[model samples]
Target: MENEKTGEVLRVASDEERDQAIIDAGFIPGWIGEGGLRPEPLHDFEPDTWNWETGRALLEAAATSINPRVAERRNIRMANSAAEKRTSLNTIHCSYQMVAPGEFARAHRHTINAGRFILESKGAFTTLEGKKVFMEPNDIILTPNWLWHGLGNENLEAPAFWIDFLDDPLVAALKTIFFEVRDEDYKEMPIKEGSHHHIRWRDLDLQLEDLVPDPNGRYGKRLQLQTPSIPTMRLYIERFDKHMTVNPVKSTANHLFICAEGSGTTKVEDKTFNWQRGDVIAVPSWKLFNHRASINATLLEITDQPVIEALGWYRETTV
Candidate 1:
């Protein structure tokens, strides 16, 4: 056992006691462990919304002053206070990052796969593995594991911001994390000759209209937009019509839901949360939850289901 507040590891007398400690901490033990899954445990995270408007205000304040460590070579600016932590699950990390006009983040490579959901931006581009991809609102960009990547904002008057999602926690937990900073002398690297500029292109209006809900759907209707680039994570959009409701359901993997459009109410266990455009909510694993949309709602769903399923540990049960 470890004391989170004091950062001290607690020693237990026996392996059984250690297993019990982990169970008390709200997690199922690994396959090789003595402690197994509990049919029902208290959900670790409740449904809640993080307002983007509040986040943007914090971003503006952070822009007034910069941290020397982060601004030394990479002149990029970010709203540290606006970053969201995955309190529900430990596998994924999410944050709202901003880059000011004429600023650039220095190139770096790491073993963790990362992706960004473009929020609002113009004249911004991300270079990954020697290919430059221009970014726009609602677009998604991915940087494969261990690929060299960097971002720059060329817009003269406007700043670019996006929601970043990464599997850094999972990589760290497995003790397979690796990182390398690019040489300062080689800052302006050239793009690869045959690399494609964009990995994914989406039209939200057309996608919403085309994604019809099934009469016997389990969780309303969702359309997956992520390709098979990152094996450990999954991204998709769940669409709900006005007054529609998704019945309670539980899953083996935890979820991070971002309200892309419209308004809705999400109920997890006994708690309920209201959401609007650009709001984010974290849902823990095996939490019985339901949703009701006052108007048509589009929620960007990020999860680690793919990784759990690949390892034959994925489970789902409708309540």
Candidate 2:
């Protein structure tokens, strides 16, 4: 065992008896073992994809078994395939949530910052900060940390679905998680017109009509969403032309992409993940990846790049 650790070590402490005494004193020999400090950032998440149809089917099935009134929220978390991480990434997390027709989840607030990308909606609304803001397909609605919000669907004909992204993992890791549920059912809220939290799809689509791909052929007609309130995360939309393949890039930030429309394949390292509308792909930190569209496509990219950059740990290499 002594010869097993053959790195540069100093002769400060000694003997088996002394080591045992140190252990008994509630301390380990610092000279032993390569510890938690790594040469670079390490993560359990890997390049993985989640099919929308599968998630929708599961959620649709859960509607009959998992009651929102009892379950509180009907969501399927996108746990990572690598290391069974039980999270989409180390710092970011995602879940596919559904609110059945005429069902509403009670109002709740938490210290974890969160937002959602609407996948299917009609007469679906979120009572955000005590006011109603209706959701539409492809819309992005933000619910920052500690902001009171509740979800519901007024449409009796169909259910509503959305992908919820959060900084819960980071919050939990920091041991600062705080949560509370409202007293009464979230109902009869006043309507909020042109709420700052709602980013309508109509506006974003109009902007993308004349947008151009990046000069370096990395990103498509990309749009960086203004989200100064959530300092831990950033949002973006990258549109790609039919059959267009973007250059591969590796970065220190975790990346999660939701296919807003069309079909495409994302190559992460040696693995290729094919995605279509409503599909999601998770590319863990420091993974080399790129996207190629089989048809004109739009992707919603969510990343913790803001926190990474803020900590002066941002790095990227494009090839």
Candidate 3:
């Protein structure tokens, strides 16, 4: 048989006895064939869009039964529907998190880098290094590896919600996952102002108002968030005018996009994902995708492009 990818050819074994002997010796001859090696990359996870309305209801239903004191967190992992996945993506994961009124999840730190994009918050705060960073809708709060952080919703009238994106899968594959919990109380943590860790929505929105699309017209009005501190992922916010459609491209970067405002539709290969405020869409590496705003909209994208680029494996092609 011909193996064009590796430029090798296979022939019938001239010595079955020797092959049997090799097997008996706990060895498989490399000349026979290869199972795991392939010519091109095969992204294992499926591209999927998770709706806020659907996830919100499920989280609401589970709120009463899910006790943060025992469960560690009350969040819904956005597990990919394909491959019977336990994570949202291969290298990264996203979860829908809810902090019920009057609930407090204790402070802890882990080797996994994580951040959250607030969807709704009347009164919710993340205690970062013993300081409370109040969460406002459309804000992004980062908790890098080994940063002691906890969450609480002291507002008695309503719960707080957010979408957390983490590089836990990458750490898991490297067998470097470590976590620890703090036994101390977080009730007395003081509020922090002008924290570099919090990216206020009001500020970003004001900035996006004056920006325009790429010179190549590949995307809508876009701004790349500075990220020297976070090496694994890249964050960007793109604003689209009503009924606008831009160029589609495929690249070797897995992406997760959260709808921060208005409504839109994203086309990923053969799939069409209709999204509204608070919805999230997951796109696997190398899939052609583009977006169109039914109304003026904003999308916050978190991607593993940095990791891919650091490995010198990043590539792209316009579709």
Q: Assess every candidate by TM-score.
A: 0.77, 0.90, 0.90
Evaluate model 2: give its TM-score.
0.90
Clashes of 3: 0
Candidate 1 vs 2: which has more lDDT: 2
lDDT of 3: 0.89
Q: Per-residue lDDT of 1-319 in model 1, one digit per residue for the tens?
A: 4434335775776777777878899976695444557656544344455666777667666765864237633222221222364333567766667777877776788899878777777878787765566787877777768878877778979988777777877898899988887633224555442233243435655766776785775555778764576888888878898989877888878787877778998887787888887667777778877788999887888899998898998888887
Clash statistics: count for each candidate = 0, 0, 0
Arrange candidates by lDDT, descending: 2, 3, 1
Put down candidate 3 lDDT per residue, 97-190, tens digits, no spaces.
Answer: 9999888998899999999999889989998899999999999998988889999998998999999999998999999999999955666667
Give the per-residue lDDT digits (tens) of candidate 2, residues 1-319: 3323336542324577557766777988776654556777666677899999999999999898998878889999999988658889889989999999988888899999999999999999998888889999999999999999988899998999999999999999999999988944446568887988899999999998878899988889999988887889999998998999989999999989999999999999999999999999999989899999999999999999999999999999974
Quote model 1's TM-score.
0.77
Off by over 4 Å in 2: 1-38, 184-187
Candidate 2 worst ten-residue window by lDDT: 3-12
**TM-score of the candidate numbered 3?**
0.90
Positional deviation of 108 in candidate 1, in angstroms? 1.3
Provide the lDDT at 100 for model 1.
76
